[model samples]
Target chain A: MTALSALIRRDIRIALRVGGGALIGVLFFLTVTVLMPFAVGPDLALLTRLGPAILWLGALLASLLTLDRLFMADHEDGSLDLIVMSRTPLELACAAKALAHWLAAGLPLIVATPVLGLLLNLDGTATLAVALTLLAGTPALTFTGMIGAALAVTLHRGGLLLAVLVLPLSIPVLIFGVAASQAAITGPLSFGTPFSILCALSLVSFVVGPFAAAASLRHGLD
Target chain B: MSLIDLANPTRFLALTARVLPWLAGATAILLLIGLYQSAMAPDDYQQGATVKIMFIHVPNAWLSMFVWGIMSVASLGTLVWRHPLADVAAKTAAPIGAAFTFLALVTGSLWGRPMWGTYWEWDARLTSVLILFLMYLGLIALWRAVEDPSRAARAAAVLTLVGAINIPIIKFSVDWWNTLHQPASVIRMGGPTLDNAFLIPLLVMAIAFSLLFITLHLAAMRNEILRRRVRSLQMMQANQKAA
Candidate 1:
């Protein structure tokens, strides 16, 4: 438990400090959402209707922006080898790293949702619903993305490869996250159904991600 | 013969050599017959000549799924049993699978233009298949991205398994979302309700496509094995020179 906590703490500190891409992800999220009103035009009604989707896409891209470094920094500094060789299981270490990534990178995107939602002309309730769905959905993105990050870690210039690999896997999360938010904002359908499924996706990825990432990391290690 | 026996690269090569000609001959015959049958079949009352696209579209769609199934099984072989040819099988199959998937998408779009009045729709089925196509491309890219063959194989195997698990979820989610495409008319509980006119040709084309995949897969695997041999020999010569 101490080892896992320590690992998580170290990762969070590194991500929050200078050169950490966590802030970059947030800034990217802001840029994507901010550009929406201008490119999409000044129609408030259209923007409001499109708000949840825009926010979700921003969050997804933001997470991707930060995810490439999940293992790259450690792999470069040789700490990844130590972590893999440590008494703590590599799977647990991977999960810890992913968890830290979500805290530093994903959490802020969710937090920024309401503010960014306003740019798209979304009202309070709609913004909240979008925020709520993003909160549920982004962990699935982070964890599943960890597999891509690990697989690409040993490659030269693997950031683009990571995106290609991770983006397809993330479609379901995007679908459900947007669906749940849409359900909440405008309703013939119940929000609970998609929301539950969204949560289930996160839970499933939480279990599968660590194992798959660890396997790829171990395989990639020389 | 046991799988272990076939694991010998030379034996596998010899077996594929014997099998390839027969497979190609059968594929050619089946494709010719299937095309003849499809061409002769009377036009559908509703869709008219455009319905003929089904012959090509359905088989490619089926092959898209079929090839993924092959990759998943080979992935299991790579990860679980560490079968010598498994990664080769998985890697070699990806581009062929991607080609089929591309064919499916393009043909589906062509069929859609005459039927659904649009070349593309955000319909769940179309979206999911597009995702599947992207996944195939990603796998192929990953195979090239990694430097080490063994490492690439293992990484790609893990990815294939991950994709296998995602496939069911993708199918289910797409089903749950609004389906713009027609529901299963061919594979449903009532079996195929498709007319014998369409059914027979469809089956033949499907068989042809499957045979094509097998023949291509075997040839590609043989090439991969030879590529590895050349790589090792080159490395050996370089090492000797260095010494």
Candidate 2:
């Protein structure tokens, strides 16, 4: 537990350090959210109706953009080899790194959600709904995305391929996140149904992501 | 012969050499029969002749998923059993699977325009199939992006398994999302509601298409094995020159 915690802390610190990956995700999220209303037209009603979707998409893409680096940095620096050779199982190490990534990168997107939400003309409740769904959904994105990150780590240029590889895997998360948020915003349907499913997806990815990532890392580095 | 015997690329090549011509012959004959049946089959009173598109569309749709299923099994062979020809099977299947998926989507869209009055709808079935197509493209891209064949095979195997698990979840979520937004307006085109006249041609066509996939997959696998041999031989020649 201490080792995992330390690994998480080290990752979080690295991500928060100068020229790090954490905050840039939020900026990308902000840019995406801000760009939506321009391409979509500035009608307030339209923006409000579209708010949840825009926020969810922004969060998805923002997290995906940052995910390509999840393992690449460690792989390049040779720490990934050491980590693989360590007593702590590679799967646990992967989960810890993902946790740190979510804390540094994903959490910030959710934090910035309400701010982006306002720009999209969403009211308080709607904004909260989007934020809440994002909170539930983004972990799944980061974790499943970690699998892509691991697979692509050995490649010299993997950024665009990473997105292509991960986005389809992220589709269910996007579906449920947007669905739950839209339900909260306006619904004849109950929010708990999709929200619960969204949570279930996150939990499933949490289990599957680490093992898959570890397996790929083992195969990749050798 | 057992799977182990076929694992040897040379044996596999010889087997395919003999089997492929027969497979191709069978596929051609089946396709002709199926096409003839589809042509003579009575058109639906409601959809008129546009209904004939089902004879083409439904088979591709079925094969789109079926081909992925085949790849996923071959992926298991690669990652678990580490079968020699398994990667070749998985790798070659990707493009064929992708092509079938493309055909499925295009035919479905063409069939949709006259029937649904639109080329596309965000219907659950359509959306899930679109996601499948994307996954196929992603798998193909992953294969091409990786330079090493063995490493690429393992990586692609992991992805294929991950995709197998996700496809069901994606389908369920899309269904939920679609239903939540609005109830399905049209009766599902390829359901049990298909009549005997339609069903017969559909089955024949489905079988014929599966044969086509098998024949192509075997031939492609043969080509891939030969290509790898050529690559290894070229590398050996380069090494000899360097010496």
Candidate 3:
């Protein structure tokens, strides 16, 4: 327990100290959100309708941009080897790192989403939906991101590869995230179906992604 | 059967070489008949002659998914059993899978222009297929990006397994989402919706395409094995010269 906590805390400290990745992702989110309105023209109604999808997509892509970095720094500095050889299992260490990543990247994106939601001309209901959907959906990103990170840890140019690997695996999250948000915006949303589906996806990734990542790390070392 | 029956590279090479010619000949015969049947088959009342593209389009789509399935199973074999040749098999299969995917997309687009009145629609089947193609390309890219052969194999295998999630999504995306693509006809309830006239030709083409993939896969695997041998030989020669 203490080891896990230390790992998580160490990862959080590294993420916070770097800070550039979080800033770039948030700025990218804001830029794309603000740009779509101009490109599509001032159809406030249309913007409001698509606001959730736009935010969700932007968040997905933005979070993806930082994924390759999740382990690249550690891998390059040889810290990854240490982590792999640590007393705690690599799977647990991966979970801790993923949690730190979610906190540093996914959590902030969700918190900023509502504010960005307004820029896209989203109404109160849509803003709330967008926020809620992002909140539920981003954990899948962190989990899957760890898998991509582990896979690409040894490569020189892995940013694009990480996107390719992670995005396809992330389709379920994208599907449910959009659905949940759309349900929220439009009338007569039961919400339970999409919400549960989103949770199921997150739960699956949370459980499975760590082990897959650990396996990937082992393969890398081998 | 012994687990290490395939551990010998020379044995694998000899075995594949012996079977490849037969597979290639069978592929040729099957493809010829299949193409002829697909060409001669009657047009659909709703879709007219363009519907005939399904003979090629559907088979390519089938092989696209089917080849990926094969690759995934091979990947699991490689990872679990540490079967050296399975990695080569999976790696060799990637481009063939990509080719099938490309054909599916192109033929689908050709069919779409006349049938759906648009070259592309953001439909579930088409979208999933596009993702599948991307996954193939990514695997192939990873194969080239890594320097070490074993490392490359492991990385690509991990990717193949990770990307396996898209297979089910591709199969069922049409059912789940309200999309422009039509639902499953042959495989769904009430058994074989299309007429036998068209279905037979489609089946022939599908079988022919798969045979062609196997033939091509064997040829490519042989080439890959030869390449690895040549690489090792060159390294040994260089070392000997330096000594």
Whole-model alpha-carbon lDDT for candidate 3: 0.78
**Tens-place lDDT digits, model 2, residues A1-222:** 998999999999988764476877876786677556446554557878998998888899999999988999998889999999999999999999999999999999988887567556677888888889989999999999999999998665579999999999999999999999989879967899999999999999999999999998998786
- Residues B25-142, candidate 2: write the lDDT tens digits: 9999999999999999998888788888888888998999998899999999998898999999999999999898878877777776675554544556765776787688778767
Which model is ahead, 1 or 2, in terms of TM-score?
Answer: 2
What TM-score does candidate 3 reach?
0.52
* lDDT, candidate 2, at B220: 94
lDDT values for all models: 0.84, 0.86, 0.78
For model 3, how does the per-residue alpha-carbon lDDT over B73-165 read when each residue is reduced to its tens digit? 889978998888889889999999999998997777677666444454334566467667767876776676555678788888888988887
Docking class of 2: incorrect
Candidate 3 TM-score for chain A: 0.95
Off by over 4 Å in 3: A1-222, B1-4, B169-191, B241-243
User: On a 0 to 1 DockQ scale, where is model 3?
Assistant: 0.03
* Pairs clashing within candidate 1: none
Segments of candidate 1 deviating more than 4 angstroms? A1-222, B179-191
lDDT of prediction 1: 0.84
Worst 10 residues of 1 chain B by lDDT: B182-191
